[model samples]
Target: MDGTLIVGVDGSGAALRALDWAADEAVRGGFPLRIVHASGWEWYEGHEPSFGINRDVVRAQA
Candidate 1:
């Protein structure tokens, strides 16, 4: 298939587990894996956003 296998992770164990399963499925089907992670903690909790994340790497690859 030309479609990708997408998984969303939010720094949770459950999400990570889902990612692992999705990865396996993607490999078995010869599809690409896309990890999607989003956070709004900075806006709600006044916390600073995370830096040095892999956003640049993902964007470059995309």
Candidate 2:
């Protein structure tokens, strides 16, 4: 109640499901939900890289 709900996104089905759940929870709780996608691997480039942080370390700091 004192903090916020933060979710991570990896473009996976599970991630999408989590997003849906977060949205629902936000609506019910009357709070805001933050969706974060972290894509920092070498394979993820261009738009993919633009989605999230580069690695877990960076996200943890955030």
- Give the number of the best model, judged by lDDT: 1
Candidate 1, residues 24-62: lDDT per residue as tens digits? 999999999999985545533653345645668645543
CA-only RMSD, every prediction: 6.6, 8.6
Residue ranges of candidate 2 with Cα displaced over 4 Å: 44-62
TM-score for each prediction?
Answer: 0.62, 0.61
Clashes of 1: 0
Candidate with the greatest TM-score versus the true structure:
1
Candidate 2: residue 14 lDDT (0-100): 90
Where does candidate 1 clash, by residue pair? none
lDDT for model 2, on a 0 to 1 scale? 0.75
- What is the C-alpha lDDT profile of model 2 across 1-62, one tens digit per residue? 74578889877889889989988988888887888886646544543444464667655743
Clashing pairs in 2: 40-54
